[model samples]
Target: MRIPGVPPAELAELNRAQDRLSFVYLERCVIHRDANAITATDEKGVVHIPAATLGVLMLGPGTSVTQQAMMLLADNGATAVWVGEQGVRYYAHGRTLARSSRLIVAQAAAVSHRDRRLDVARAMYRMRFPDEADTRALTMQQLRGREGARVRRCYREHAERTGIGWQNRTYDPEDFDSGDPVNQALSAAHACLYGIVHAVIVALGASPALGFVHTGNERSFVYDIADLYKAEVTIPVAFDVAASGSTDIGSDTRRAVRDRAHDGAILHRCVRDIRALLLQPGAAGPIDEAWLDEDAGDDTLRLWDDDGAELASGRNYAGEVDF
Candidate 1:
């Protein structure tokens, strides 16, 4: 769900639509899909399509497309078509579909970036736990003494878990050392969990790649959300399960861990924190003291602190609508 080089505000507007049938994330392939005589085509080098409304989604270079299933999408008045690795150069009937796709891309981008603050927290969580901490606390020269030491302690505790390895930490991607069985297993598990996060984000009508904390290169905001639960959920569960002699992330174990995370209050706490951050008067844009009272509806919604105390009650939305 990443289309780089596009403006966040424009993307946010498109995402607010609740009735769109489907969206495309064509970052690597050219795609085409059709529904009710409406077809959209996404081509090379274009992150936002400016044509067609409902027919086809064409993927070229640097793009991706997602749907529950190809047949399902087509039946639902949509089509998912890919043009392979080399990328597509031409389509049978191009202009019409391309125009529609542009509009779709705009709307999709807006929806995807709707929750920037949640994106940030999720990314922070991922970079900190469950995914091996590559940097040693003591080794980071810039870190203050106490901060460095505390980070190291946490890192060591997390590193001891199974499915935690030292590939990115110690070796280059081109190096053969990355093939170690332990590292491979860790990578595989992390990948599966990442996918689960992506599915969750998609279900929530949120973008999976755009993030508040991580750079654009990572292309996995969902991975960030999954990372947040690492310390609070994934890492602990993984270590305990593995310590008991289970190594693989079998379907049952994966489901169990996911359910535990879902039911756990920590994630909710983090989400609430994120929501509050979003509600901050000046967080989205500039703060307007006069508009605060009128912006947030009175008593219709209430936000409690960790101790369950009311904070602020005035709505001050500015930049874009909340989804």
Candidate 2:
């Protein structure tokens, strides 16, 4: 997914060269070129993207392009265009633009909050350590105590509820070693959260760094959003799937662990939950328009209008391309 806010300055044009597009992250075997092919690089040293398969290149503001690249891009189906941090401003090819002040405001109001998400994360963590006397059923709100009694209660209860075998023991964060059941569950929870957040980032079309809730220099906006769904979806399923896959919850279980997180129904529910979260008023907020703008938005992001039309509000939309 793309970020909602653009960088403060113009992107640096590092280089431009011609290369045949082979499929990597390419979702489909389609490609387009706009006038001059410009290669942009962020300060983070991540390579800037070239034209994408099945996606039209929308030039940003102050963007320079050659007529030849533009002709090839448009003719080859660079569906629409966007200008600067704003959004889709034009349809250089056979595409349309959409967006409005009301829409932006609505989208900004729909993302979820940190405290609630942390609560959910804590819950998932407890489920994984069900048999531990010091870590189950504890909410983040109650995690501040040095004794961690609340967490212990939750863990004991979790063990009882799941009827799982466990060593009734106190969890000392320091005493834990690799491949311990508790640690394994926690790792799975983290991975599941990562996958879910990545999916959410893809859906929202917002930069994972420009987040609504979790914040830090090490920004993983995708991880933050996905954290919200872990307790509700990913964590539980991961545990069950992992246990079912192997008696030992170790590296051998990682694939099953990842697979449950990626299960179609679970992922779909997570996506639906994210969409619902983002659409709520001031909870998660509405979808960002920049996410849908061909210039700034990730083309994979999908938005719907009140009229049930599959389009980004106020930004022109190309026909839907199912992943």
Candidate 3:
């Protein structure tokens, strides 16, 4: 895929360093490709979103996006996610950054190996509670208990500081309308955090279905990564937004979470954390084209002709055909 203005070298650099891009969230807008830019139009006016420089685009309720805009996003390595109100629910996701899938292989290996998987899980717990003395000795059950207690304390502290009534989190997906404003706000904030974490996980080519701290479901890994940042980012933001008594609690919470994410450089932190957790120290460096070609055998590889049709023989560019 040829990106129009950017040269090949610069484009490669941009694709490799997507961790530096900022994240944008859009709701109730129409997104379309305008020349080389992705333009979003709302009742107010049209605004150009720098898709290439975006890590994630959260498309919330009432968002309509054109195919061309999606293609542009895919070409530029930006992830687009369809979400519910204030990003409280994830509906779907677009194409991920087409880089090497070595990270995915490594992640799968780590998660599938019983001993290493436990180590990775412990690493995740240690990251969440850095002050914990001995994460290595704690079983998954003990870790869960500690995490639950820590989260409860975070809720209590935030509620006290923001003067919002502290209540157990209660939300009915079937009837979000009937849920408490505080619960709704908390859900919204956590959703944004999850979206961001999910995008980073996908960009790194890691399987979201595989998780260490969290297990089961499609977004288990996403939940695990988002938990690392919840107390610092979403928890407080939720409380503050709810305390403000805003009529649009969900929108207010999402906006505050976005601001906090930007201020905290959460995407960069997520990237660093994922690398640290998944990749062992002194592991082989980033996978290269040669490594990928060697790993993908001839039977699994497909050779394409110039007209976008697959050739009969499974051959690569070297012209040394494999039958």
Who wins the TM-score comparison?
Answer: 3
Q: State the C-alpha lDDT per candidate.
A: 0.37, 0.39, 0.77
lDDT, candidate 3, 175-200, per-residue tens: 66677888988888888888888888
lDDT of 2 by residue, 1-323 (tens): 87663222211221101111211121112222323343333334323344322132434445444454444333332233432221112212222112223323333443244554543344333333445455334545554452245435644555555555545443333332334464455454454345334433332333445444455623345555554454444445434544454555533334444455445444444444444443333332334543333233233445766876665456644555454
Error of 3 at 183 (Å): 0.9
Worst 10 residues of 2 by lDDT: 15-24
Candidate 1: regions farther than 4 A off? 1-152, 158-189, 218-220, 247-253, 265-323
Kindly report the root-mean-square deviation of model 1 from the true structure over all alpha carbons. Answer: 15.4
On lDDT, the stronger of 1 and 2 is 2
Question: For candidate 1, what is the total of clashing residue pairs?
Answer: 50
Using lDDT as the yardstick, the better of models 2 and 3 is: 3
- Give each prediction's root-mean-square deviation over alpha carbons: 15.4, 16.5, 6.6
Ten contiguous residues with the weakest lDDT in model 1: 91-100
Candidate 2 structure lDDT: 0.39
Q: CA shift at 249, candidate 1, in angstroms?
A: 4.7
